[model samples]
Target: MYNVDDVVMYGTFGICKITAVEKRNFTGEEQEYFVLRHVNSDKNVFYVPTDNEAALSKLHSVCSKSDVDALISHMNSEKLIWIDNDAKRKEEYSRIIKEADYHEIIMLIKTLYLRRKELGAAGKKLRSSDENYLNLAENMLFEEFAYALDIERREVVDYIEKHIA
Candidate 1:
């Protein structure tokens, strides 16, 4: 259970700071929800049930700068797997994004990039769902990394571009 002011990853919502925790009446029963505000978009807020399985693990800044450095160092080498069917790929990518795992996000990004490159070489354009998934994955990862490093999302993007290249 997270307390007030705790930052947690909620599926695809990315890093959210717990602003409040209260019990509200729901269908003749009382349930607890965590009021969270997005770290990147301060205007966006979400109320999550305390026991949602989609709410995987909590991310804490236990790693030192060297660990972050190592993660960055390995960013480019991450492998991305491509699914043949668009619908199935979208569903799978959506679930993976919601899990909010850093390594998973890296895989998504790398996969998308490689897929795009392959399609480009074949004189084909990326599908709309592919574009959407790429954007979502990038935003989610950038937001979390920005919060963890105490930097802006743009800075995180710049750092990733530099390190991944």
Candidate 2:
């Protein structure tokens, strides 16, 4: 359970600050909801149910700088098992992304970069689905990384490159 002003990661919304924990009835029952606002954007606000396990599962911790560094160090070892069939790959990768694990997300980004490079060499491009997944994964990972590491989101790629190179 997070308290007010606690920053957390939520699915594709990335870094969010818990603004309040109040009982609101958007549905029908007056149930408790965690009110959150996007850290980067005031326009985006979310009210997440306190009792919904699945929704709450998407609410995750924002790593500290040291923790982020540790995760970056592990980037080399974390990798996705490549599925050759597009449909299978999409299904498997989607599940992996939705899991919201940092290690797995780093792996996903690496895998997509490699695959995109391979396809480029062959005069092809990443499928639309793959591209969308890549964008989503990058956004989620980098937002938390930027907030935690105290760096601009655009600097994340360069930071990773310097660390892992």
TM per candidate comes to 0.80, 0.96
Q: lDDT tens string, model 2, 1-165? A: 888999999888788999999999898879999999998899999999999999999998788999989999888888666678999999978997899888778888889988999999999999999989899889988988889889999999899889998
TM-score for candidate 2, please give it: 0.96
Q: Lowest lDDT 10-mer window, candidate 2?
A: 75-84
lDDT of 1: 0.74
Candidate lDDT (C-alpha), each: 0.74, 0.89
Best by lDDT: 2
Off by over 4 Å in 1: 40-42, 52-67
Enumerate residue pairs that collide in model 1: 11-98
